[model samples]
Target: METFDETDRRILSVLQREADIALEELGARVGLSRNACWRRVRALETRGVITGRVALLDPAKLGFGLMVFIQVHAARHDAEWLEKFGRAVREMPEILGVYRMTGDLDYLIRARVADVADYDKLYQRLIRKVELNDVSASFVMEELKDALALPL
Candidate 1:
């Protein structure tokens, strides 16, 4: 792990919240000169501490109002089955995250859709691409908290 002083933590915290903030402004917030701040940010990137910045979008605003968690039970546990499933999910735009899991479920998929009809269409498309022993879905009624920021 990379060692971080208080200044590094401050810079990371500010960047996590406001990635596009001007370098001068960011320096002011973190008590450093612009050049120094830039150097540290570059170091963080080089060291793989800071990955990449992205714009977070709202699913509702984009006409995808339904969020579903899908529990998938694979028909086969062979390498070929796993490969096909991975490729199919990678090509699917609606799938936000896919996880290999323990317990009763083989995999878990997080996805967004317009409605139940849309979700059904996604289900049809998915099944046509890969075989599954069983599948179940749970719709999110309310999202109390959703976050991407990791603690520094």
Candidate 2:
């Protein structure tokens, strides 16, 4: 892992929330010159500290109001089963995130859809691809807090 100084942390903390901010302005915000900021950002990119920037979209505004968290128990814990499961989940656009867990649940899947019906379709598609021992879903009625920014 690459070690980052306080300046890098400040730069990253600011950039996380305002990815498209102009370098000159970003430099001012982070207390650095424009060229210095550019160089640091370039180094960050090269070291994989900064990944690609993307627009954050509202699921509700896009007609996808339902957010579901699925707890999946795998039928098999072998490498082949893991690969198949990963591939299956990765192919589904509705699935926003997939996480392997250390608890009773083998995997946790976060998905957004238009409604329960859309989620049903996604569930059907998921099961068709891989055999799961058990699948439990929780629908999110309200999101208390949702932020992609990491604490510096």
Candidate 3:
């Protein structure tokens, strides 16, 4: 792990809150010249501190109002089967995230869809594509808190 200095932490905090802040303003806030600030930002990027910036979208507004978590258990553990399942998951737009878990479930998938019918279609498609011994799903009733910001 890389140790971050006060300036780096300040830069990261400011950037996380306001990514569109002007370089001059960011430098002023961080007590550095524009050139120095730019260099630090560049170094941070080179070191993989800043991965990539993206616009977070609203799922409900995009017609995906239902959020569901699906637990998948494969019929058998094999390299080929796991590869195929992973590929299928990558091609699925509704699948927001897929993880290889360490519990009873082999894979945990987060999906968003329009309705129950949409979920049914997605479930059928997934089952048809992968050889699953068991599949269980849980629909999210309410999202109390969902934030991407990591505590630094």
Candidate 4:
């Protein structure tokens, strides 16, 4: 990744809060001319710092009331099995995120479902699709904080 200058950092900080902010407004806030600010923003996007803008949604309103984290342990590290597991995870709508870990678990998954029963059904389907040796799930009772913005 390319190192960001002070101006670039300022631009990123403001953009993280509100990606829809107008280019003129962003330039004004960062004390840059419209053209300079536009170039900086374009560079950020080109360098993959700004991946893409998106609308943050309410999970509950979207019919995903239950948030659960699952730790999955695969039987072994086989290329074919890993590929299949990755593909299954990508295809599962309920699985919002997946991370390969360095701890006791092979993979950590974040998923949202309707309820406990819904989670149970998802669990069954997930295990059947992947050759997981062990699986542990924990339901989130209260979400204290969830922020996607990086501290720039």
Q: Find the candidate with the highest TM-score and give its number.
A: 2
- Write the candidate numbers in order of decreasing lDDT: 1, 2, 4, 3
Taking the tens digit of each residue's C-alpha lDDT, what string does model 2 give over 28-138? 988999999999999999989898898899889998999999999999989999999999999999999999999788899999999999999999999999999999999
C-alpha lDDT of residue 25 in model 1: 97
lDDT of each: 0.95, 0.94, 0.92, 0.94
In lDDT terms, which candidate is top? 1
Per-residue accuracy of model 4 over 47-81 as CA lDDT, tens digit each:
89899998888999989989999999998798999
Tally clashes: model 4: 0
Ranking by TM-score: 2, 4, 1, 3
lDDT of 1 by residue, 5-118 (tens): 999999999889889999999999989999999999999999999999887888899999999999999999999999999999999999999999999899999999999999
Residue pairs whose backbone atoms clash in candidate 4: none
Q: Per-residue lDDT for 130 in model 4?
A: 81
Those runs of model 1 whose alpha carbons end farther than 4 Å from true positions after fitting are none
Clashing pairs in 2: none
TM accuracy, model 2? 0.97
For candidate 4, the per-residue lDDT at 102 reads 97
What's the lDDT for candidate 4?
A: 0.94
Instruction: After superposing candidate 2 on the true structure, give the runs of residues whose Cα lies further than 4 Å from its correct spot.
Output: none
Each prediction's RMSD to truth: 1.2, 0.9, 1.5, 1.1
What is candidate 3's CA lDDT for residue 1? 92
